[model samples]
Target: MSTNPGRVKKDEGFLGKLGGTLARKKRSKEVSDLHEEGKNAINAPLLPSSAELLPEDLLLEENAERSMLDPTSREDPKFKDLQKVLIDWINNELEEDRIIVKDLEEDLYDGQVLQKLFEKLSGRKLNVAEVTQSEIGQKQKLQTVLEAVNELLRPQGWTIEWGVDSIHSKNLVAIVYLLVALAMHYMAPIRLPEHVSVHVVVVKKKEGILQTAQVTKELTTTTEMMMGRFERDAFDTLLDHAPDKLNVVKTSLITFVNKHLNKLNLEVTELESQFADGVYLVLLMGLLEDYFVPLYNFYLTPESFEQKVHNVAFAFELMQDGGLKKPKARPEDVVNLNLKSTLRVLYNLFTNYKSAD
Candidate 1:
């Protein structure tokens, strides 16, 4: 492997042709020395042994020197301060990221230590919050709220029914209130829950082929029978009779039409829009449970049934006038009797009527 061609050169003549032999050896030696000098200048300390060396010895020498890539053991003192950075960089890129090392085994042989040890360490704090949610918790919450309402109404002989509802959208929790209406008395503007958007409307129903009072003449009847009471002429108009655009503030009602009506599977159409329909339904349900049911619970006395219906609807109106801003301070004194008026209407619609479509 000697590139020191002059030292290895022999003074020999081919077939004893001394002049020609000596001249060729001298030329070869000059070329070898020039190539060796250039290679050493190109990569001084970093250069591997010249390739002309014997293969076995050449590789052995390379291994004998600490590799520049091995920062921890390589004897470049400048590398001493950069071991942590080198380890981190290798972990991110070259080492396939086995960096989550949390061993405190206190049983490592020196040869088993993979990365260099840390000398200085600093503390760090992580910010994390814990959260928990469960179906059991949600069901329990619904049950607890229902139970309290039921218990409050128990003395008045009012029965309460509750269950989960299938929802196309979770925001339409209003469907939950509708499903719980076995607790209410009348069924016109089905009550709503709180904290949802809603529309309270003033709608008119006919009675006995005559124009009549919505409250007085519409009593003791389901919605189907009441609609049937209208004259054919009135029915024709009724189909088109959008309720007067009342200034409904706090009260909310969902249009029971097509995709807007179904709490599940609502679809949007270019011809019509379901504006706040899901949110409206939830809001109405909240209003029902929060305001209507409590009022109905208080007035379960026989005579109070009719008045409660009229008053609750009126209260819904008053909400627009900004009167019913809050629930009555004493809820017990204000609730009215349940005459099965609302439930009776609901049964008629749910069980007996043809599809509203």
Candidate 2:
């Protein structure tokens, strides 16, 4: 029986013969080692065909076991002392908040919370006669910074889109907000005084390695586009409340990327930017998100409060530079542990718990 005409024979060339010989040798060497090592193999012990691992053997409760063995558990005196210090710090913070709240209650009828905040911030008390004078001084100081920012952006023709309804009214709230805008502008890790272009790269996790999936030049433009006509309104709202707009933007951006990542097989390592303004904006936002607490009850819902605590805890784990430390797992573990410790304090604040007593 002859083979079909379409059947192809193996290469009979010298190079092909040599390649085939080398491949065969490699396979034989591998099998020989496996056979030789089989009796005393560096492998798990042989198991019965239907065997299942015991719960203890699987080490699922390893953390509980380790904590029991630990000498520095919460029951230790050192931790108890630390807890006291934490409570004291929280009390101090709450005391400040209470003062602010009392002041806001007085100022709300007049819509003067911003003036009161600025007064408190400046550490000078203003009587009725001096309040306007103090506000003028505050605006002037803020104006100096705003002018500097504007001059910096003027050459580039990239003026910030001030929310027309929100900013144009020139109310005390608006002026204070402008000051915040300037502060955030300056707080940005990158100075925006010079014209700069920005680029963003989207990365994906693939086989335990980060791989670039997409690159967009002008990431701010893309984000602004995503924000659309509501950009200014959204920014105004951030300035209006305790939640840092910059933080919200960044978290929302990263979350957006991660959410859409489905089957794209990507874990976010970090979002990176070359633009000084963009980088600085991110840092400024993170700072505010972690630290800024609204004095009044308007912005103090439980969900928002919890989010602020979460953001702050997350920020504490970061290095001065925006990049996450590597190897990534260690920093993440540390952050998680710290977050748990922080949550206890946050819970106390939430429930108005004053002390162990």
Candidate 3:
């Protein structure tokens, strides 16, 4: 059977064209699919690699579950007591500024109160906005404040456990840890309830499965544990080993006293002799309490020894009224210029009102 050569050639060409068209369509579909995948890659969220996951990142991921078991949420009695003590201490420090911190999470999340506190404790101002309303602004302010704080604490070899995101997110565990650290650093007079602990939910990923475990975390350790023995016995150690440092302590205390008393046109030069008369003591109490003591309540001149004792006693009474812890020193001891007694009273006042404006 002889087929026509031209017809055969034409049929082969047509088949070749059809095969080329089909191949072109297949290539176009593959290219389209690859382009679509590229677009997805560009639009998709970039997640951290396994090696990039930090402890803080892990903690943040578990926040939702951990929050439910937080101390503030559960109202754990011990934790509540610790919170009250810390809150009261913060309120006392910020009393002059009229900033009250009822909840550590809410008030401190914005970083304004924390900034004020750092300024009050360190006597150094931070370069940050006075008020930040927006969430981003608040976080920026928190970063600045925490950086400054870490700089201050770095010399002491303190470990910072909180981060900006942790604090801004109102992580109570991180918040309380930070507050406790600040209190210890500043030697806040208020006693933080010791050995406070809370239950927390810790999450981890194993293989591909999520695992959680409840853990008892200690919120605060005692001062002795947090600080070295020398820090705990600093005054006594200074007195015994380095008596000259006592002068520095005295000078610092005098400076602190004069700073507050300067408003009344008074300066404390001699801590022992000047306060022995009891007039300065009375005025100091009145100034710190933000109230005026009636002239009749205390003697202005106080020449007589008994009159001086009476004035000192009246100042002690005012201290008690102002919610200050009662002084162990007797009124007569202060009147007699007993350095120990005089220092005890003044130190108490200084601890309580150092943040006073």
Candidate topping TM-score: 3
The TM-score of predicted model 1 comes to 0.16
**Cα distance off (Å), candidate 1, residue 2:** 86
Error of 3 at 350 (Å): 25
lDDT of 3 by residue, 206-243 (tens): 44333455567787776334422222344456656998
Q: Can you list the residue pairs that collide in candidate 2?
A: 188-280, 189-280, 205-266
Q: Kindly indicate the candidate among 2 and 3 with the higher lDDT.
A: 3
lDDT (10s digit) by residue, model 2, range 38-142: 843532232212223334323433222100111223244533343343234323333555533332112322324433443444454434332333545545443
Candidate 2's TM-score reads 0.20
Model 1 scores what on Cα lDDT? 0.29
lDDT of each: 0.29, 0.34, 0.77
Model 2 spans > 4 angstroms off: 1-130, 133-302, 305-357
Rank candidates, lDDT, best first.
3, 2, 1
TM-score of each: 0.16, 0.20, 0.48
Error of 3 at 65 (Å): 10
Error of 3 at 271 (Å): 25
